[model samples]
Target: MCRSGTAMRLTALTLLALLLTACGAGGGQDAQKGGRKPVFPVQVLEVQGGTVEYAISSTGSVEAFEQVLVTARVRGVIEKVNFREGQEVNPGDILVEIEPQRYRNELEAAQARLDKADASLKDAQAGLKRREDANRQTPGIFSPDEVESWRNRVNSAKADVSQATADVKIAQLNLRDAFATAPMAGIIQSRSVQSGAYVQPGALIATLLRRDPLLLRFTVDEDEARSLKQGQQATFTVTDVDQPLKAVLTHIAASASSRSRMVEVIAEVAPEDRERVRPGTFARIRIVTGSRDNAPAIPQTAVRPTERGFVAFVVENGQARMRLLTLGLRTEDGRVEVREGVKPGEKLVVRGAEALKDGVAVKIDEPVQPQDK
Candidate 1:
């Protein structure tokens, strides 16, 4: 009975095995028909070599090209202020007027003294001529000592006249100085003294700023500063301004700042853009440090930063391949220069790279052309 039971169990197991084999064969056939790996859709660009301009960004303030402090040249009561605050003035434009009565009176007094001295000089010359005539006509009639005395008197009168004439010139100059004039063309920044106020010589009257060509002052780190050169182009934008100001680097400090260890740089704003900006306005400046020509470049979206280095995806043989790159300059636009590990004319996956893995199959749309550098 035990032998018969064992034989039945083996027959049941054999039938179950046959049913499993048939199901496995059917599953294998289905997989063979419909098991193709997915092809990821992606956007790509043909990598091209072009010029890349590297920039260093820094913040700075706009300053006037030149600043002048207008001062009072003579002491008097301020009679009239000819200019309002922030008025545009030209060279020789009268800005302030001091009370001219005092200066006028002084000039008149000097003129009168000069006239008196002139008359005295004439009298002295006439006297000396008369004495000489008398001595020549009558020999020994006038003593030598007496002739010498006449000559000395004439010389004294001439000296007095000369002194009075110099005083008159000084008085004339003082009167002219009573009216303060602009020494240069600029915009008045402030008005320190008002009409009817007393002012002394050398007292601050107003501040003037030359705004036709503004100056932009900024600082760079030690490495960037060392590489800076005069005549490099820079562009800056200020708050609330739609347009940017173009400038050229004109000056670089010989030594770095003691406190910050950064070097100072100066740039002159383009003449056409100066009036649009004002001094002390904060600006963000991008200075062109260097440029690369015909360098392999890719769009910024294609590159991803990782712990080891930067990684990019390139399409090769209808599959995505990962590339490690040594990067150089990033241009003003969105292109990044690849220093190593990439070549021109290669297909770069600019978009749809987030989901891509190395060696994955990809279905690319129409390849994009690279933009002008």
Candidate 2:
């Protein structure tokens, strides 16, 4: 029995040794594999070259190229109103006509007076000639004093004829002015006189606005306004208009507003677009200052606003690198032009960049991305 007991103790010791050996091997493997460092999952985009337009956008309203108040110049009853409130009229188009009878009578009366004065002058000249002929035929038949008196009469008659001629011209002008005409080609904004209404000189007849070269008046930042040229091309989009329009910058204010720090600018609508848009229509304008092709650009979401300016994250060799970017104009398509710092072909962290620290490990989430433009 003592020998069997000793054999059982030896078997138990061998079993314990095998178990310890297995445990030791497993612990060694665990120590060698030491756990992986945490990696931040991020979305990255490849920077690509794109066409970037440097443009400034602003809001404004359309304005008439010229506004004028049409007024009557002669006193008479309004014979006719030839246009509606919004009808377009051309230069020399009659807008209102006064009674022709009264103006015609005045002109005729002035002409009759001129004829009478001319007849008197002719009679005086004939009498003077007779007196001179008698003096020549018979010496001292008529005294020199008599001849001088006749000459004076002729001079006075000549003055009367001259005065009457001026009166006739004045009357003729009044007859012509009886018909009120448009001085320029324009749209009638309002009409104040109607048919059969008695109107005096200088009475309001209508309001006319010139149609050609419609102006787009808008306010822009002073910095942007200062660089604008007189003939710079502009694009316009008006409310309810499906197609965009065009204009040319025509006028810029010499000074900026003190309160708003903005400059007033006027752009002339393109000839083809003038008829499409009207004065007082609200519009948005875009002025392209420059353009760059093959410029490095990235998604706008990749950037973070910083106090100094802006910053973005670039992933290089499995780590995030913070870069200060000199950004250019931001496009409507959600991309920002990188003027400096970042370059094309670099990996830009977009989706999860906000949570990443500089030089931290990042695992790029690869997904099918649409083309960036």
Candidate 3:
């Protein structure tokens, strides 16, 4: 009886030992599975505030402020063209000269007539003086009717002299008109009439463009137009030009076009840069609507679209924290303005943001480098 009791006790102790070991193994497995750590490879950036300019880009053409179509003012055969094709000219520079022989002959005839009229006026004055003296010497002997006739003849001779003087002035003006001169300083873009081509009054001879202080015209959409104002500064780039040209906003249309729903804007280029640009060239305009000082911004690549809103991953205490951000304007490059949800001097995960989640542990294998301008 004593041996059997001992055996039963030993068996119970062995079973209890086995049960304790199984419980310990189950606890170990739970710990290994539940306490697993998340590992993330990320790139980080320091966020800071600075001046940020928001710009709108549009394509437009370069234009001239003053474009003139040169035309003949008088009808005649073109004798000589003083200006060559694509020549630059100043105001009052003679561009073309018509045949002046006809006008010269008319002027000579007018001068001869004027000379004859002057001689006739001298004779008429002498006659009037003689008639007045006769009237004074013999008031009753000289008939009043005869004196009146002499007065009328003197008046008629004076009228003839006045008419001839007017003719002479008209002839001189015609001779001056034979030479066509430029009305403004500009470059000759095209020439339509040759040296020997017969041209009438108002015939197109050439086209001139005022290139100095050139004008640039562009249209902006309704949303963009709302941000623009007069007297703003803008920069533009043209094809084949290495650097951008600067200009000032001169005008903003008060009303938008009904059909296109766009507003027209005009910018004036500086005179010094006019030689490098030409009219009708395509250009790209960047207009700055507003600017922010000391604002937090991040590379556009760092931002990712999420279900809630735009989000960016930030590395804090070696863990990834997803932040909801409010965005502002985008810069010319790939950077975007962060209005809220991020502070300056905080590191942002730029490269590995896509593969990250909230509370994930991150290991920054490489540092992020800024892009070149």
Candidate 4:
């Protein structure tokens, strides 16, 4: 009975040993598999060489190329308002008419005075001629002083005639100015005086604005302003309009502003686009300063900012490889120029890149596709 009991105990111990060994093997296998590096699911894009435009973006307001304050040049009662508010006018188009009756009478009076003065001048010259003839025919009949006096009288009459002629011209000018005409081709923004409103010289009549080929006034940083040149191509969009408007950079401030430290710039819109945008409308301007040809560019989303300038992940041999990028100008779109550390046709990890490290295994979640320009 003792021997049988010992045999049963040894058999149970052997069975327990085998169970422990199997458990140890299974745990070791699990640990070994768990220690292997993980493969990350990712999406990537292939780099391409394309034309990239370097641009400076800014905000600005629309302005009229020419704005003028129409003022009355003569004192009179406004008789007629020929143009309504907001009416387009051409050069020499009559805008307002003042009562000309009083000015007409003044002109007539001036002309009569001139005529009288002319007759007096003629009479004075005739007398001087008669005196000189008498003096020449009979020596010592008229003294030198007397002849001189006649000559002086003729000079005085001539001066009076000249003054009268000048007065007549002044009166004519006043009469003509009584009818105010447009000095330029523009739109009347506002009319301050109505018919029968009395106005004096320099009185506000209306405001005129040249709308065609409007000016877009914007400001830029000092560096960008320095790079800008006359006739540079640009574009802008307003909140109200879907279509972008094109313009040409025309002027740059010689010095920067004190408050904003930015230089002001002016861009001229095309005539066809002028009516679509109004003065004082806010605009977002993008000035195309230059272009890059055959530049390898990547999506902005693929670039990750690092303690060092920037880094991007590119897939090589099914592994995430890190690259330090020397970035160049960023295009208006989100594409950034890769100046160094990348090449065309390289697959850049756009998705699942943030969690990747150098030499991490990568399982491409989506096939590489051509980047839409």
Cα RMSDs, all models: 5.3, 6.2, 6.4, 3.9
Candidate 1 global CA lDDT score: 0.89
**Which residue runs does candidate 2 get wrong by more than 4 Å?**
1-36, 219-222, 252-264, 306-309, 365-373
For model 3, what is the C-alpha lDDT against the true structure?
Answer: 0.87
What TM-score, over all chains together, does every model reach? 0.75, 0.82, 0.79, 0.84
Between candidates 1 and 2, name the one with more favorable lDDT: 2
Give the per-residue lDDT of model 4 (tens digit) for 1-373: 9999999999999999999999999999999988977899998888889888888999999998789898898998999999988799998898888888889999999999999999999998998899899988998888889889889989999999999999999999999899888889999998899998999999998899988669999999999998899988899999999999999988999999999899999999977888888898999999887888889988888899999879999999999999999999886667789999799988888888879999999999866575542
1-373 per-residue lDDT for model 3 (tens digits): 9999999999999999999999999999999988958787877778878999888999898998888998887788999888877799999998888878888999999999999988887887888788789778877566778778778877888898899999999989878878888889999988888988898989998899888779999999988988888788889999978999988889889999999998899999866677778899999999887789999979988889888999998888989999999999888778999999899999888886777889989998677766621
Pitting candidate 3 against candidate 4, the one with the higher TM-score is 4
Q: Please give the RMSD of candidate 1 to the true structure.
A: 5.3
- Encode model 2's per-residue lDDT on 131-244: one tens digit a residue: 999988997898999899989989999999999999999999998898899999999999898899998899999999997879999999889987798999999999878998
Top-down TM-score ranking:
4, 2, 3, 1
lDDT rank order: 4, 2, 1, 3
Off by over 4 Å in 3: 1-42, 140-148, 220-232, 258-261, 288-290, 305-308, 352-357, 361-367
Model 4 has an lDDT value of 0.90
Best by TM-score: 4
Q: Model 1: how far is 292 from its true place, Å?
A: 4.2
